[model samples]
Target: MEQNRCEKSTLLLSVVIGVALHGSYSTLFNPLTGPWSIFPLISLVLAVYCLYQRYLNQPMTDGMPKLIFSFFLLGLFGYNAYLKTSNPEMGSNFFSSVCIVIIAYGFIVKLNSVNVYVNRKKTLRKHRKQSNINCYQLLVVNTARF
Candidate 1:
């Protein structure tokens, strides 16, 4: 069914986001220490939760998970930009972080759009079913009058 396909696509998107988060963490924060280490861990946990939700056929309609990841990536991009400004040697990191941020933003937009589509489809189906039931009831009433 279309719903199943939507669920699968959402799951795939979540997996991609997870992989991207891991890549960003590895590339940008290798040997990360202090309180900064928690950011990636938080992202990882959110990704896992999102995946689990999708697996359960309860994909979040609010797009909160992707939004959170996008915000995290934006913060990372800002930090990298600041570091690059202070030390030109960090240019590569800054560039990579920028790329990651852009990619994450794109994915987030896509994921949210997909979620909206699924939701609309679900609502349409519900309305169709309701209308069918109403039609059936009307038919039954007319038949009874005979």
Candidate 2:
């Protein structure tokens, strides 16, 4: 059950980042000046929440500074995308930005997945450690009796 919770949180992290980065880029390359800022801001907020949860719930994964910084890239991507669809003023530059955003999003998702998997694996290691301690005590007791 705990593992499931961790996995779910990790996936949610990806979704929020994906949306936020797209939104952020829209603000940059897009001449429309529409809702591009919302993506990065929203993504940052979610990232903050994750950090808060990290401190409050697990307290183990204390290395998310990179994740926090990545939000900026996400915002850039979102703003670029927004410009492409809204204002044709940016021209082909917007399209190229769009490609950049897509590639960035993919890499972000992959990185996030690896971090989550490591977190869960760490949990398993603790459980294994406890079992090993118990087995060693049992073995010593049997040998003493013999």
Provide the overall lDDT of each model, using Cα atoms, as 2-decimal numbers: 0.63, 0.62
> Candidate 1 on 1-146: residue-level lDDT in tens?
77656655565555455554654565466443223445555666776676666658755546556554555555456555544565565445757566677867787788798889989999999999999999999999999999
How high is the lDDT of residue 115 in model 2? 86
> What TM-score does structure 1 among the candidates reach?
0.41
User: Model 2 — which ten-residue stretch has the worst lDDT?
Assistant: 59-68
- Which segments of candidate 2 are over 4 A away from where they belong? 1-62, 93-141
For model 1, name the residue pairs that clash.
none
The regions of model 1 sitting more than 4 angstroms off are: 1-92
Model 1 worst lDDT window (10 residues): 30-39
